[model samples]
Target: MKLKLCVSNTDVLLSTLSAIQPLRKLCVLRFTPVHLCIISMALNEPQAWCKISQEVFPLYEVESIRDNVLCVETNIDPLINALRNFDKSNSDGLSIRLQRRPVANEGPESSKKNRSMAVLSLIYTEHVSMASSRSYSFKIPVKVLKAEIDQGIVEPQLTHAEVLMKLDRDILPLFRRIERYKRSGYICVTGTNRGRLELSIEEDSRKVQLSWKEFLQVQQLEGETQQQSQFSTQDQDMPHSVQIKLKDWRLGAKLTELCYKVVMIISENHALVLHCILNEDETAEVTYYIGGKIQDQE
Candidate 1:
């Protein structure tokens, strides 16, 4: 398996990794002929999923016999730290190459048990002068998946949500309010298809509610999205409510800072999706999927 990638505009990658870095978990790097996807899937933590097209990168190549795709999971902090310290102007372009480290802690067996075994080396070529140039490499350790054994992942499929709204306000303050409730382990969100939303949490004898009267609705495709008349359709007008983990909700809030627009999708009491869009062209996006709190979990 061989995979190499180079991007002229590192802003997309930098911003995306920076946003999701707060999750502090290993992220999956999926390299295909078409695009690259960075994902972090966890049961108790917020799941972050995003896609970046090959067109976004001037150089993208992947070679593999099975499925013609390569998937590796690794910690993103090193890469983020390297980019943070690197001078963007001096960067000719960032080149990535996959390499196998002798001892991997990915699976069951390892020497130290905590060290990463595989890596995607980050190579930066810097031109010092007219004819002088310098090169630096940082090995961002990864866990390469075995194509024959591991089933690749796909984006989660959700039933059409009852309400999807375009939120324009910052959500940081809302999360701050929820933080004060020591007894509130979860946050209850109620909303209508017509753009009304309510977020609240309860602490022992106290209750705090934050409401928004109106907001822009998400544009839908012919079958995907349309109008849900609040007046005519009784069910459409009825608000859908779901309780999500306060911790995950707060993590979702961090995504808003990385996006140009924020969209919330609710599915009654089943699940919630926080769609964070980074660009208008849809070249890059980071979305968080939060499952509703189950009774037994409480």
Candidate 2:
């Protein structure tokens, strides 16, 4: 299998991955002719799932072994370390390729190892060279696991009561402020007929609420409009809140510096979904799913 893609904005891609690096240790990378996706799932309960996507990476060229799909599992740190070396300013362009290295025969009398090493070749050119362009490459060894990979992309199912809203401002600042109060907090989100949205956090006896009176845009998913219509008069005006671990919410904040916009979906008492747009064109995006915290009974 051969796969290569020329990255248009290396910084954006690297930053997105770095933001997700803390989510899990191992990441599953799936490559197709049209897109490249990085997926991670937390092993423990209150599990977190993230999927980062890059559509047309300036250039996309691929030759797959099985039905045009290639999946590999690799350590996240090493890949991030290798990619951080890229000098976005002086670099012309970056291209990544998947290759296999043949096992070397140790001796004439000994048989060669049957296993081949899978490597990711990252090649970038330095435009600083005057007479001749200098090219540097790093070959990172990645493990090709025998485990079956999911070919289709899947997101956590949302209930009818879920409210999805687009934020006009960056959420990092708000998240940072809440971090000082506690390690986790409940997010109470409310929408009004006047197109205003409010996000609040309550702790101890203090309640902090931030409002965007004219800055929010409500997004209607496939059946969301019909669902909203079913809401009773009081339910439509009441706040929809979900409890989330601050640690997990911080992960979404890390992407704020790299992503241009953040869209949040809160399922009252169920889950919090964050969809981050990484580029101006909105072609690149990352979605995060964090299960909500359950409140204690009164």
Cα-based lDDT for every prediction: 0.75, 0.65
In order, what is each prediction's RMSD in angstroms?
4.6, 4.3
lDDT of 1 by residue, 201-259 (tens): 87788888887655547543334233544335533455778889887777786677557
Worst 10 residues of 2 by lDDT: 43-52
Overlapping backbone residue pairs in candidate 1 total 2
Model 1 worst lDDT window (10 residues): 221-230
lDDT (Cα, 0-100) at 137 in candidate 2: 83
lDDT of 1 at 232: 55
